[model samples]
Target chain A: MSFKDILNSGKFVVTAEVGPPKGTDIKEMIHHIELLKGKVDALNVTDNQSAVMRICSMAVCRICLDHGVEPILQMTCRDRNRIGLQSDLLGASVLNIKNVLCMTGDHVLAGDHKQAKPVYDLESVQLLGVVNSLNNGKDMSGNDLRGATDFFQGAVVTPEANPLEPQLIKFEKKVKAGAKFFQSQAIYDINRFKEFMKYARRFPVKMLAGIVVLKSAGMANFINNNVPGIRVPQELIDELKAAGKEKALDTGLNIAARHIKQLKDENICDGVHIMAIGMEDKVPIIMERAGLL
Target chain B: MIITKKRELQELMENLKNYKSFFLIGCSECASLCGTGNQEAIDSLTESLKAEGKEVTGGFVPKTGCQVLGTKVELKPFKEALDKSDCILVMSCGAGTQAAVEIFEDKPVYPTNDSLFLGNMTRFQMFDERCSLCGKCILDKTGGICPVTACPKGILNGPCGGCKDGKCEVSPDIKCAWVRIYERMKRLDKLQELCDTVLEAKDWSQNIKPRTLATRPEKKEEKKK
Candidate 1:
């Protein structure tokens, strides 16, 4: 079934992220696709995730289609201007890769190429508007297109952001921009997320709580220190530390699984978008542990 | 005001290697306040060039280096020095460097400073950019806060998923532009307005490079004819 259909079916939608390799070697990526094909509703191919250079997400999305898996093409405004972004959207549509997650991408300074120019010609809200425009058979300039796209557009939100008012304002803007679905930034505090949902439930859109599996207490600490808009609670860190070195990975998976199960059981939101970064192989384990399989 | 940072002497030397004698030009406006094109800066460069065994023909700080006609008139006294020089080093913004280029057709001109941004000097030797000159102004709608310059990503509808503790993801020292806008709007009792409005895609054609504008009434009258 199409991702749109799955989202409309009221079933708990599961989406996982897959980062393309830095080099042309696709064996590892294909292996990931093979492992994750039927497990999740669709695989979101990241666009140079974390601003690190990688193979294009469009190509990986096309590859997923060939392997009988739905693909959500993640596009960032950090690298492409409106022209490039619109052109890529048309290209993705032609490739039959419809699901798109618009984001204002990480800064170029955050990436490997610190000196590279950051092209944020369109931010997430504007990009979502652009996607809606394309789907309606026009470009950003209101010019006609030879053929329009039929894209299931998605955007991102940060429920855990400090000074939550700004994020809430932008979130409402994203919804108005024609974002059909939203995959949020990583979430750890369920109660805080529930509080955000109290406001978000008013919108006529689907929300997916983002889940990033923790590998260790050190990794959790690093995320708390470095990652923006995300704070892993001290309790989770203590739990990971207590799990011991060898079993921490399993502990991390359990934490992710527990979050998913709660989100699903409580109908907190529509679904979950798991970002098992660099640990795509462990996603299936998380799903199975969550009773999703 | 235009913010400028002086280029490294070693790098400037590479550009000036082929030239023997040099004439320097400085701006008494923004560059002076920036300490990049003041009289003291010119004297320091003169000493450095003399130490490097290169001849300093002469130099002057113009009232406004970007005013082509006035700068040309002001530079008349330096004709002999300019004639003797192989290069002209402009110690101001890019506009000042281009002024030197326009004034001296034969001599190779180089900038001694990098024009960083249009900004205000918030403190002694401290500057903050408050405008991006994006051609269109949305300050009235944004409670007078310009996100195009304040936000590193120039996101119109932000803070984008990277804001933490009201600080920007790019730097903890920098406050999120949207948060500031939110606060300003709230203070003005325009929070509901802020929430109700959704900014459309920016008309970047207005920001197209090499942009030119003439605000003179004479030009408008001539165009009307």
Candidate 2:
């Protein structure tokens, strides 16, 4: 079933992140896709995830389609002006790609190429509106399109953001701009996420809680210290520490599986979006442990 | 006011290698306040150039270096010194450098300061960029806080996923611009208006560069007559 259909079907959905290789070697990416073909409802192809330069998300999405898997084209406003963004949306539609996730994207400063210019011509909310306009047979300029797009658009939110009210305000704006679903930032604290869901449920859109599998205690501490709007709780970090170096990966996967299980059993929201950054080989194991298999 | 910072002396000297002598010009307005075009700065540069074994014909700080007509009138007294120079070094913003370019068609002109952003002097020497001058203003909707300028990404509807602790993801030192706008709007009991308003895609054509404006009155009266 299409991702949109799955969301509407009210079945507990699962999506995973797939970052394109920095270079042209797609062998590992293809392998990752093959492993996750039936495991996820859709695969979100990150556009230079964490502002690091990588192969374009569109090309990878096309590859996912070739492999008989649904792809979510993640588009960011940091690298493209309005013209470039709108044209890429059209190109995605031409390639028969359906799902698009609009994001403001990390600033170029955070990336490897710190000197590159950032083009935030449109933010996430504005980009969502642009996608809605394209779907409605009109451009952002109100000009008619000979052939309009049919994208199932989504956006992102930070449920754990310290100043949660502004993020919520922007979240509602994204909803009004026609976001069908929201795949949130990495979530580690389930109770806090549940509280956020309580407020988010007021909107009609589906919420996919983001679950990033921690690789180790050190990685969790790095995220807590560096990554904004995400807090990996102390007990989880200590749990990974107790697991030792070799066992940390398994422990992390188990932790992720536990979150997914709890979220699914509690009927928290719509589903979960798992991000196993660089650990794609372990996602299936995570799913199996979560009883998803 | 437009902020400016001095270019490195070595870099300026490398650019001035071909010139045997120079006539320095400074501005008394924003540049003077910024210390880039003040009399003391000119004297220091004069000393530095002399130490480098280069001739300094003359130097002066005008009331407003960018005022083409006024600068032209003020420079008449230094015509002989100007003619003796191989180049003119403008110790002000790019506009001031261009003013010298317009005046000295024969002599080469170079700017000694890089014109930074349009900002306010928050403290004695500290400046903060407050306006991006995107042509369109949405300050009314944002309760007077400009996200376009303050937000590192300039997100219209933001406090993007990167906002943490009411601070920007780029740096903890910088408060998230959208958060400030939200707090201000809430204090004014205009959160409803903030929520109801969905800012459309910006009219980027309005921000097209090399922008020009002449605020003269329309010729309606003359045309009617």
lDDT of each: 0.92, 0.92
Candidate 1 chain A weakest ten by summed lDDT: A159-168
Q: Across residues A195-235, which tens digit of lDDT does each residue of candidate 1 receive?
A: 98988989999999999999999999999988887889999
DockQ, in order, for the candidates?
Answer: 0.78, 0.82
Clashing pairs in model 1?
A: none
lDDT of 1 at B189: 98
The sequence of per-residue lDDT tens digits that candidate 1 reaches over residues B100-126 is 899888879999999999998999879
TM-score for all predictions? 0.95, 0.96
Q: Show model 1 residue runs off by greater than 4 Å.
A: B219-225
